[model samples]
Target: MIVSKRIAAVAAAVGLAVTGLAGTAAAAPAASTDLRLIAFNDFHGNLQPPAGSSGRVVLSNGTTVDAGGAAYLATHIAQLRGQVKNSLVLSGGDNIGASPLTSALFHDEPTIDFLNQVGVSASVIGNHELDEGYQELLRMQFGGCHPTDGCQFEKPFRGAKFPFVASNITFDNGLPAALPVTIKFVDNVPVAIIGVTLHDLPSVVTPEAIKGLKFGDEVQALNKTSRLLDLAGIRTQVVLMHQGDSTEGGGPDDCRTLPGPARDIATRASASIDVFLTGHSHQQYNCVVTDPAGNPRPLIQGASFGRLLSVVDLKINKRTGDVDRSATVAHNEVVTRTVTPDPTVQALVDKAVTLSGPIANRQVGTITADLTRTASPAGETPLGDVIADAQLAGTQGNQAVIAMTNPGGIRTDLVYATSPAGEGNGVVTYGEAFAVQPFSNIMQTITLTGAQLKNTLEQQWQASGTKFLQISSSLHYSWSQSATQGNRVSNITVNGTPVDPAGAYRVSVNNFLAAGGDGFAELKNGTNLAGGPVDLDAFTAYLTAHPNLAPPASDRVTVLP
Candidate 1:
């Protein structure tokens, strides 16, 4: 199958018309082409079966099953493919980055290798794709030895066997950041697929990573590209979008309360769209929402980290190359452990273990209890608090008195019995600590005025949800619920002294935030910036230095009623 290159013809015509939504379905021509699309999202390079709640699949039938791992995922994908005459494997994105020690230790080559072997045709580029920066993302797609470290795997690195489609992302030169749209031909008919991640990807990743990139509005990109594809004679439009939203529903396939950027985009984008595949929220649901033309269309999302797969069975009208919308169906299938694991993918995972497992398994320290990343209503977590303290202590030499870590930085909970290593319970390993903070971001300390710090905290409440910054124990602040946005935070103090709005404070954060990874853009304005050890190392050192660590009290930030 020939993948699509950038389509320059539509470069000048980026935005599509957003006419008022309709009230009824628009009919398409009869006679169809049966094609199956098996889609998953946010694999996050979990080569091993994800432990704890991250890997369990909850079926609508009320039965739970342990699911995921590259091997099992490969097996289930192959099984799904076997049942269809014309089938293609798909992903919403984030197949790599913020990964486990198994894959991240080697820069996610094992994941790329597994996805290629399992036949991942194409996927949208999730924000994590730019975790290492844009050049690294290109390298992941085009193939090459790492610029800093040469080949680490058995052979020279070849890029993904798939194109990463991102229609909404473009460069300043007016070209798509990635190969925008790809069509998978089924029975000589083109099934148009346009992929785009969140328009706010820069807020979720290091700002520096996306220095030269421009993110087009999601609705505009979809609307424009769908129209262009329609003009080019392709009628079956499938959107592989990484931007996602969650819904309150009866079960896995309900769309009753569908609302978010994804839902908004679905209802406002071009009416030519047939199916919407998405990720980012990492939740699972198969929904049918009224499109711009008022026709109902399937909007699906697979649970994150290889836990589930969304199988979209599309009946494309052979006569007009349009989707038979009424007959389309989608299911969020659990990647159950009952299926026989694919030995080929298993061997690849095993080989990765052999190469990196030794260092990964080394004991770092022990904790008295589980230092979890699970946040409270205030978004404070035991792990995050600990990490914030770590960054503070680690950078004390740089005159840093305060530190804040992003909640997204904490990937997994610090489990007590997660490993098979017999060092007893509550024992922390290098790999386990690595899993908690996997971004490989360097430690950075910068100067922020007391007023700017408050502004940074206020920026958190401005997002969809309040992203409460994990603060060092030395700093304390009170938040008023009834207070307005900029004034919500108050009673700021450092080392028992109320912070003067004009006073300067030395603050530390991972390199991601120092360069404004999240929406806290003020962090970028800090001067006298200095980089220290990588984040994971700083975290590991904290655990090693503080034996018998305990969870911190969730009272640092007082929330007023």
Candidate 2:
């Protein structure tokens, strides 16, 4: 243990070795320099116990355990905090937006309230933070009534006490919108944490949400921020990054096969960064990657929905103010149900549930079976088909004959069994539908030539190697794994008519797709655009119109050998 503690003296916040002129042995390390960093990410306003698979964690032992809830998280956090005197709790963002019914109903006030109550120092701005747009995000930071919705809570809604930092986001004028670094003192030691979202924010977020804001290069931003912090004499630096990598077929805590933007960033960024707390991929990993200078840096992501918590022990050297990287150790801990739920957090949750219950619990429609998000090899999911159809229906007034949606937009599986929201088996509710398509994206109809539609589909496999789009019943096509990328999509038809290069057709898509979000730049080529209802409204209307919605056969897209 002494040896482990001795290594905490990394280049940042680390005290130099106090050796005599005669080369005396090093003295005992100071206990006051130890700083406990408790971190989590991608919370997404899951104030209640997350439903179904969202609330479960699979341990390295291969056993699945139920986890998460604000109450239990509060208990776990307080207990962990109690064990250490000098500590700072942090998050990697997505703390709000894409939220469940309980928090989203009031515009995620409860999420901010929870964070403030728990003493979260700061968080980076995630893609979801812009879900409602920049002005809305500002409102979240500095409280007021919704421009349209007014205040939903009983009392006036005061905003977050913690600061939001996004090192890479800047105004069109090149001025930073958020502070690049936040400094906190623990035992008179200043620890600087730099925060930034992924570099590819424009690709994943709606164009409307990021209208005039520009996301700067992440590596450049971090390097500049670290240098500034170093100049300011705050060398014990960490990065709260809202981007991550996934290890295929690896356990939650496995890092042996790491490959993703997070790893790539660690490989490119300056070695002065001691650790990275990442999110967005929603995959859990606790691994150390070598930085550009060959120094080891810890990169961790606690899985989404409060299911996991990352606890890190960092010791700084008093005199040098550098991290004892040698003494740093981190691990992802499961927020197991064995821990007692904090009554205070539960009370807050109970009040939120009480206010949100009526609308969330009321049944909207019935389903014959689960409309799972699991896609076939051809990229067709039952839930996706239903969502596509809903968008088509919503845009029919605008002459939309077919619709498509991004697979990543679908958040969860629509189960046939009774849900945690207390609805009956096979019954769907407003809250469930909202949870399925929570981004509040408006449906849009646009005119696209047959060739343009073809280009959009092919573009999916071009830039990023394929993020398949879910198609409406009016559209049908087949692709083969053996064929070349451009030649893969074939037998394309709309309403049983073969696509003609010169023919124009009305296409239905969410505003995100309309703006070429997700790398489908061809979408931006569509002309004669017309706006339609919000996506959730369209989906709820579909459920209301078809009282007994059945899962589409999952046969829309064919995968051939």
Q: List per-prediction Cα lDDT, in the order shown.
A: 0.82, 0.82
The alpha-carbon lDDT assigned to residue 165 of candidate 1 equals 87
Local error of candidate 2 at residue 279 (angstroms) = 1.0
TM-score of each: 0.91, 0.91
Off by over 4 Å in 1: 1-30, 58-65, 246-251, 254-258, 420-423
Q: What is the overall TM-score of model 2 with all chains considered together?
A: 0.91
Model 2 CA deviation exceeding 4 Å by range: 1-32, 61-63, 256-258, 462-465
Q: For residues 36-126, what per-residue lDDT tens digits would candidate 2 score against the true structure?
A: 8888899999988786677788777777898998889988989888887676788899999889888999999988889888878788899
Model 1 C-alpha RMSD vs. true structure (Å) is 5.5
